[model samples]
Target: MGNIYAGVDLGGTTVKLGLLTDEASLIRKWEIPTRKDDGGKQVIPDIAASIKKNMEEEGIRFSELAGAGLGVPGPIRQDGYLEVCVNIGPGMRDMNPVKDLSGLLGGIPVKGGNDANVAALGEMWQGGGKGYRDVVAVTLGTGVGGGVILDGHIVAGSKGMGGEIGHMVMDWDWKEAEVCNCGNRGCLEQIASATGIARHARIFMRESDRPSVLRDLQRVTARDVFDAAKAGDGLAEDVADYCMMYLARAMAYVSQVVDPEIFVIGGGVSRAGQYLLDLIKEHYDPLIKLTRGKAKLALARLGNDAGIYGAAKMVIDEREK
Candidate 1:
């Protein structure tokens, strides 16, 4: 009685798996180490093994499996191939992921998309973004990733590469380029990513001769900067403010295109909570098209599980559709 669906989030370090019931209730969840050296081959085998192991451990049968969805951290081609995933490895790029993974799963229908997009889908279907007609979700991890939903459906653009608000150029004159994996420069991602925040702190700490109350370390993290900002360190506050300014501009630009009613923020940096949200709202209003300032903001409730739920939604919807 194929009553269960599966969702897998393939990241650089780990693969998160979730077994969900027909009604979208999560049944079981676990993680597996990612084998980056084996390229895409290990991914499918690992995913298959995880699914089989979970079914056996939980006493479920293959006959009860419905479908599987995957959230892969890379630019997925319109036809469902992995075009590039710098976080993983080379050669896996431009590979037909959907075909390969489905084959590895014994022809089980497998659907795949960018990790961030699927994560947003997960939140919309089961987490904070639920019950909303239009929503945009951004996961503030090592780099910024985004997904857009319109009227209860995911919006994949003509190229199937939509919802890329992270690449929205906020400051054309800045000329500061970090070189994204996408081969672009001076992108908003370079400014608002977790790495950006930490880099900002490092730059500040270096230029000042005064000893920072923050423990002088070789490298400061985004969380450390947030803590310093909360503690009223002038340098940290300035850096955080810069991040807020860029984030606001990026959100405003996205709103102009997607016009989503709610913007749901997730990821490790988002844990900064109202402090971060408040700063974003402060600048978001001024940067937005005056006519489009009505969009609201919200925090993601699902945390890391969003990718799995989203992946499940992808497979289940395909099966039911």
Candidate 2:
């Protein structure tokens, strides 16, 4: 047994905590409901308490920990300050998570980072990006999220918005494009996200007489479109192709800049699996002119646990430093 480390994935609904050895072996993992009372002021304290409780039960002590790391939904500055976490609450805005959590844990060293970026690190450390140093991770869920890892370190950029692949503009004209939550028009998130896939299906069904089983359902999802497309539904097929095409375009654009060795796709929409990868490659292969077919794509191996793993990796890396 080696020194234990703690990792926290703080979300709007739940806080996932994991205890891992210095060797990156997960010893225990658990979750607790996020109490948003008092503007999320209790989140850090609650996490510390949970870790202490669990360590006590496991016959471990705080002194035995190498360090701790926290992953937040919002951007995290280089100094471990959370610029703003809208999903958590207003109180967490402009707070130093590293200091707050460390204070609660008796001055133990703590690290903080953007949740999506940390998830990418987790993938690189033990998931799909394993055995590779330079990697790009794309998460397709309700909205698109991405993280860039080069030389086994996260590229959070100056303001912690480096790997925001979702905001990449796909349509410069804004023609037939919907406004993204980021106030941008024709962002990759507008067309390639899960919500975007379903929206495309709805629009296709409305514009054309092409029949699809999606028409029978009250609501269509990205999964429904993939399933219908696999079953030879022309309408759903079009929708799937459109979404994957845009996603590939985004990846193609990223490849030109970062030139990652591999792309690890994750999140709910990625459940489409090899079918989704094939669709992406079908379009991706044509767009690359220089580094053609160099970047390989793979599915993310660590589902929801990527964040915690990445967080723990942050601590482990810091100890090495």
Candidate 3:
């Protein structure tokens, strides 16, 4: 067997750890609860201990491993400093994850990046963006998160805010748009995210006399809207189209800047499948005059495993360097 590598996906509720070969094949995976008590100071130590326990159980030696990589839920600077991780706790703010994690793991090399970026790397390595060097990955979940991979490397930017495609303002007029969680008025997150899709459904139901199957449900989701549209509901189609148009517009703007070869859409909302992709493409094609219909769109294949795979890839790439 090749040298083993460790990947950690640190989340607010659980810490997912994976063991993979240098060739990126998954050997085993497990998870532990994230003990957030005492300001989350024990999180890193807990991870280190878990790695040690797993290594012993698997009869693996530290020297036989190729280091580790971490995917954190916040902005990570180029030097491995996490700006702020609200979900983990205030204690993790302004901390050097790579340094602290490596120290805990007996000086083994460690690398870290934003979770979304790491997920993108995973997709590029083994999922939807596989075989593509330059790619854009967007996860349209409760909120929109994205990562830009250029020349097979993550563009983490100076402040680690490089692929913040969600916060891009789509509507400047606050009067007609809802305020985003980021305190902005009409960010793409406000209309293109999963929650945003439901919000649009509510708004359309309130303003129009047209009835939708969505009105029958106590809670409407992005899935319901897409399903209703497939059933040929007029109001649902309108809501779906409106939500997708903003996302398409955002992609068009991103293309003008980075111009990636493909766009991989993931997250809970993306489960709408080919129908959603077609809707976005329908609106996206006309907006871009220069690179019309050049970028390919695909669904994410890795699902929850993407983060760990990306984290493992980070270690593999670092070892190569």
Compared with the true structure, all predictions reach lDDT values of 0.81, 0.90, 0.89
By TM-score, the better pick of 1 and 2 is 2
Please give, for residues 1-321, the per-residue lDDT of candidate 3 as tens digits: 237889899988999999998788898889989989987888999998998898888888767667899999899987799889989897788888888999988787788999999999999999999999999999999899999999999888999998999999987776455577678888988888999899989999999888778999999998899999989999999999998998999998889999999999999998999999999989988888874356889999998888899998988898888
For candidate 3, the per-residue lDDT at 310 reads 90
Clashes of each: 0, 0, 0
Using alpha carbons, what is the TM-score of model 1?
0.91
Ranking by lDDT: 2, 3, 1
Candidate 2 per-residue lDDT over residues 41-61, each given as its tens digit: 999889999999998888887
RMSD (Cα, Å) of model 3? 1.5
Which candidate ranks first by lDDT, i.e. highest? Answer: 2
Which is the winner by TM-score between candidate 1 and candidate 3?
A: 3
Q: Which regions of candidate 1 are displaced past 4 Å?
A: 175-178, 207-212, 215-218
Off by over 4 Å in 3: 176-178
